[model samples]
Target: MEIAVCRAADVALLDECIGSPGAVSSHARRFARQGEGGGTYLVAWIDGRPVGHAEVIWDGCAAPEVRAALPGCPELNGLGVWPPELRSRGIGGALIRRAEELAREYGRTVLGLGVAADNPRAADLYARLGYRRLTDYVDRWSYEDRDGVIRECVDPCTFLTKELPSGSLDVKRT
Candidate 1:
């Protein structure tokens, strides 16, 4: 298995993993628009097949309240491991660790992520990984569906944060 940052050449493989060509194109565009201090996508591959992904957003997009509570923390968003059978294989954890590495590369000392209030399983996993709830937040965003129709979403979530140890970029994955 290989975990690495996604590049332009990985679009088709990402599309295959995500099962949405439009979404892949959108991600590709976002990756291209990223500047020197911007964010990028990370993908996990097994046997040359993409299986998981996450986004390391340098410009944290947390709500104002959450942002004020934990300033200067980059966000790890859109983390997913494809197909039900792939769960518990550590792909998600690996992707998250990669996000932390990317955050460290950006000179950030903290990382943040939002979990749906109802998702205890994910919240538990985050807690076990040392993330603590900072505050409640609402995630407002929009995206185009596979049919090119735009949809808006507002999720009630809990903002969680983890302080990264300085100079710990070389921390090994468990």
Candidate 2:
């Protein structure tokens, strides 16, 4: 699999394959086409097909509490893999590793990410990638679904932060 920053032309195919699990279909269009934010979407492709994706939020943590706690620490958010069978095959981890590299390129020393409190598998994955829990908080957000209906999400999350090393591109896993 190859990880690359998403291009505008890739959005439609990405959506057709991934279908936005967290009401983030808009984001694929946003970053991939509009380039509205400081961050970008890193896409995982295999055999010329988009398989996974994650966002590098250069501005830092999206959660207010996490932002206040770790100011200016860019975040890796909205990670997902396409086709349930493709999960657990290191796609998510590779996207995260590429995000870290992008953060370093931006001269950032640390990166932060939030994991839903109930998802132990993800927490374990982040831990193996060298992220340590900093605090827990209610992650609240609202989004407009495909039907244009406003949805409220109030998830309890554990915010984690990792110090990106200046050297070595290998992602640590244990």
In order of listing, the candidates' clash counts read 0, 0
lDDT of 1 by residue, 1-174 (tens): 688778777877676566644443655655664535477788888888888878877778658978798777788888888886997888888888878877777788899999997888789889988999888988997778778888888889998999887774675643
Off by over 4 Å in 2: 21-24, 29-34, 167-174
| lDDT values for all models | 0.79, 0.82
Q: What is the lDDT of residue 95 in candidate 2?
A: 90
**Candidate 2, overall lDDT?**
0.82
**Residue-level lDDT tens digits of model 2 in 68-130:** 788888878888888879989999988988888888778889988899988999999999999
The true-versus-predicted C-alpha distance at residue 120 of model 1, in Å, is 1.6
